[model samples]
Target: MQKTVLNEDHRRSGARMVDFGGWEMPLHYGSQIEEHHAVRRDAGMFDVSHMCVVDITGLDSAAFLRRLIANNIDRLQVAGKALYSAMLNEAGGVIDDLIVYYLDESNYRLVINAGTAAKDLRWMAGRLADWQLAATITQRREGAGALAMIAVQGPNARQKVWQALPDCRSACESLQPFFAARCGDLFIARTGYTGEDGYEITLPAEQASELWTALADTGVQPCGLGARDTLRLEAGMNLYGQDMDENISPLDAGLAWTVDLVAPRDFVGKAALVTRPQQQQFLGLLLKDRGVLRAHQKVVTSQGAGEITSGSFSPTMQQSIALARLPLAAAIGDTVEVAIRDKLLAARVVKPCFVRKGSILV
Candidate 1:
């Protein structure tokens, strides 16, 4: 199994390790619930080096991305600006959800999921060939060089991160959300998956351990994938394979806002998306009774039956919540029954986000 630069550090800190996307990653340091609460109340850091970072460079970079992804790349006019989009097949199914950073006119960076990295690269290469564009894709994982990524998140996340790298304070302190900036070799982005104020920093692998130590010295709690999952679920963020996959379209995956259908520009999935009627609607559920929600549980509604794509006990809300895709008739405020084991539990339909920046929304 592949291991990140911080694998040894995780072991030294007594983290419970698990296999995730072919990488031996930390599931939790000790208590997953405590880690989740730490991120919600204060600062927490996560080792995310398993994610793939690809650099796209060439004269036609912008043109190539415009036709490759569902979101309009033309919106990324400023340097260091980032756009969240889905790379789709011709049938409008989501291949992967990614964040593309516009570094310059001829250069852009994409962060893709670890499990889908190989397939995404292959798909991108074929698209480059089919379009006959001059753009080039370089996977950063190749060669002797290694890259380490870390996400420090929550209310105090940015403060602790700045304390660790004081020299980068000015460069990244004023960065707006969804934007990135470079301080020497360190690429700092004011972005995160936990729906909290934080930075996702990418630097040379050799420097990762030292940085992780420095951040820990600043009292930033080390979090694991388990807490990260609960945090993202509470934030209403979608997981790639669980919420949507090659068989699901962005329109039905609570990602319609990310898809640009009004623009006249044609993209890879434009034809299919325009022709296909949206069959399912993705929404959130709040269980009224006591029980843990889990994926694949049957959801019964007055309209029809649906299945939970992602579900968990929300640490911040202290309740079981989930993201479910049901028929269009399942509207907000509607009551539904979830089949948990032999019991059918009642739940209320609500908007996807349960919390944001530590505040309860629903």
Candidate 2:
């Protein structure tokens, strides 16, 4: 397995290493539940260097991105603004979900999933070649220009990050959500997957350890992938491969809101989406019976059968909750049966989001 820059540090801190997308990353330092609670109640950090960061530039950069992403890039009129979008295939299948930071008309930054980084790069290259665009793609994952990313999240995340890096406070203190600011060599974005207020800091690879140490010294707990998964699940965020993939349409994956179909602008999969109507309604399910919901579990609804896309024991809710792709006829208030083991368990349909900013929505 490939090791990130913090692999040694994670080992030193007694992190239980696990293979995630070919990279040996920490599953947890000690108690996974405790780490999950720490993020919900206090400040916690994660090493996200395994994810890929690509910089797009050149004269046709804006045009290339407008045609590339499902979300309209024209909304990013101001610098430092970021947009959450899905890059879809010609068939409207979701290629990947990413956060694009708009720096200027000629430059933008994309943070993509680690598991699909290689494939995403190849796909983007192919599209560029076909379009003959003048945009240049530069990946900041390795070599001299390598960058290490750290996500500081939770309610007190910003304050702790400010305490650790005092110089960045003034610039990023007023930074709104879904925005980014470049402070010296640091590219700080006010974006997080854990449904909380925080910043995703990207800095030179060599300076990563020092920064992590500083943040840890400031009482920021180091979290791992185990906590990361539960947090994102509770926040109603999608996992690239589990929740949706190349064969899954964004419309069916609860990501239709991210697609800009209203705009006149054309995109890769706009035609397909226009021709085909919504097939399923993506929603949340809360287990009423004492059982845990898992992915691929069959959901028996009034209209027809569906399946759980992402399910787990929500730390904040203390119940088994899931995100499922159900039939359009399934209403939010309806009760459904899920096949757990040998018996069918009861689950209530609700909004996909169960938790946000420490508030229990469900």
How do the residues 100-160 of candidate 1 rate in per-residue lDDT, one tens digit apiece?
A: 9999989999999999999999999999999999999988754556678999999999999
Cα lDDT tens digits for candidate 2, 1-362: 98889888899999999999899999999989999998999989999999999999999999999999999999999999999999999999999999999999999999999989999999999999999999999999988799999999999999999999999999899999999998999999999989888999999999999999999999999999999999999999999998899888899999998999999999999999999979999999999999899999999998999999999999899999999999999998899999998999999999999999999998
lDDT scores in order: 0.94, 0.94
> What does the lDDT come to for candidate 1?
0.94
**What lDDT is reached at residue 279 by model 2?**
96
Ten residues in sequence with the least summed lDDT for candidate 1: 139-148
Q: Evaluate model 2: give its lDDT.
A: 0.94
lDDT of 1 at 127: 95
Worst 10 residues of 2 by lDDT: 2-11
Clashes of each: 0, 0
Quickly count the clashes in candidate 1. 0
TM-score of 1: 0.99
How does residue 342 of candidate 1 score in lDDT?
98
Reference-based TM-score of each model: 0.99, 0.99
